[model samples]
Target: MMRQTRLNIRWRLTIWNALAFAFILVAFGIGVYQLLRQAHFDMLDKSLKNRLVTLEESLQEGSSVEDAIRDWVGKFGEHSDYFAFVCDGLQNTVGATATLNQVDINRLLPNLINDYGGTAHDSAFGRIRYASREVQSHGQPLRIYVLAELEHLDEELLLVRRTFLFAIPPALVLSAALSYLLAVRALSPVEKLRLKTDSISATDLHERIAIANPNDEIGHLTATINSLLARLDESFDEIKRFTADASHELRTPIAIIRSEAEMGLHNDADHSRTNKRLSSIVEECGRLTNLTSQLLALSRAESSINKSNMKPISIDRLLTEVVEALEPLA
Candidate 1:
């Protein structure tokens, strides 16, 4: 028994649309997240470099660098921007707007000054970000470190990330809807073909599937199915004609045999003559039977050949068997 496979075009379209939407969502999300992160970090570096330049100018002027830094810190501290510290080349703290803990001054300060000459170094101190800068002032090299807490930046980034996350569902929904609409538009001709196929029946097998677009695969499929239907319709018509012709041709011999048999039986004829007529009638009946059986067998064999599952047989043996079987008839 053959199991029927049911197809639902809408379900197929929905699944494919969802997959495409998911791919676009993931790609866009990753791109947006990376771009935002890069922009945020760049802004932080630029702000730090600008602050370092201002601090350098104060020191070069021989003004009280501490007071200048304190004033600047006072102005910017309310904004929660950064903390600054100035140190000599010997790693001794010369001036600082904000006091540093002993460990930070000892361990991290020297490393920042050594590695980056007139450059910034970003580091983390207990969840806070510090952008440290080394500078030269009045022919003397100095180190200036700026500490800016990243909690607020992280919070904002988190908000942006959450916004993106929230946007994804809507984005995916919109994209899926768009994809489905597009797929439907693209497959409109296929849908029409399906409806036409459903309308087709054995009685209307001569009807061909309509083709709206000839360049597409669906159009090609429509053309091929229509061609197949045409062939099937032609074959059925030929079979009907052949069956009618064969019946007509066989009827005369069959009627003649029946009439001869009846006449022989009715007449009180000689036994030998009666036997001869009976034998002739029997031979005619046998010939008719053989012809009908051959037609049926040929029809069955043709069906099997079309299906292409016939077992391989030796042609020579088959021909010999056919000749032997027909010898009695001959």
Candidate 2:
């Protein structure tokens, strides 16, 4: 199933951390873009409104459209991102900044005071934010248009977006790597415990795992396992003691039975059926005596009580035998 094939804890942690970091990073990038875009547009709108207001006042104070355009153009200078133009009652362009073209004037000119006060797209400038106002110029109805290009704004935002795009993948990879390393470090104790547990067997129940700390969760779990092993050791010892005791008790009874059977066999030798029965009893007692002796030996082996008379093996010979035994499997 999918559960069995799923990623390990370390990989899962890395994935989760990467995902969380990606989300936060992307969210921060988007928020920064939104704030900068809004701020740029706000400043642009305020400038356009101020320019329109100043131009309206100039025209109202009996200033000719040409004089107003000249003054505004000089104030803006050569590197200006805005263009100002004026149209008379006939909708003919009477005055405009030096950079204004026929297409820019035609596509972007507002028809009424209510026409524009926000952003618009233009074929000449690609994108522009504009503000328009109707003003009295020498007692004739006049409309003035102010357009600021949105190209710079778009470029700035695009730069910000690109920076985030370039940074996200590397940041996610770094986060994943760090998370994986931390997971491995954190789970090392569990791995050690697993290795230690794997080495334990029925014959080696006395072996124990070392605990570094007794307060943490891993330490507590190891302590519980150690307690369980202790109980198991005690139970096995009890079983061995019972085996030895039963074997010792059975030895004398079986010997006595064999002697009685032999006597009966001799006394009943003239009767063939009775002699056969006594012979069978004698054979069974011999088997029982052998079984008890084997049981006693097993009990002693389990307790290691029969090894007192044995001498220590030579280290060189032991190593050679061990290597020979393992070479085939290897």
* Cα lDDT, model 2, residue 143: 85
In model 1, the runs with Cα more than 4 Å from the true position are 1-7, 60-79, 98-114, 117-126, 135-141, 178-188, 293-330
TM-scores for every candidate against the unseen true structure: 0.74, 0.68
Estimate, for each residue in 93-171, the C-alpha lDDT of model 1 and write its tens digit.
7776555555556665644543433333335443444565666676788767766666777888899889988988888
**Global lDDT of model 1:** 0.71
**Error in Å for residue 72 of model 2:** 2.4
Q: Best by TM-score, which number?
A: 1
* Candidate no. 2 TM-score: 0.68
When summed lDDT is taken over every stretch of 10 residues in candidate 2, the lowest stretch is 321-330
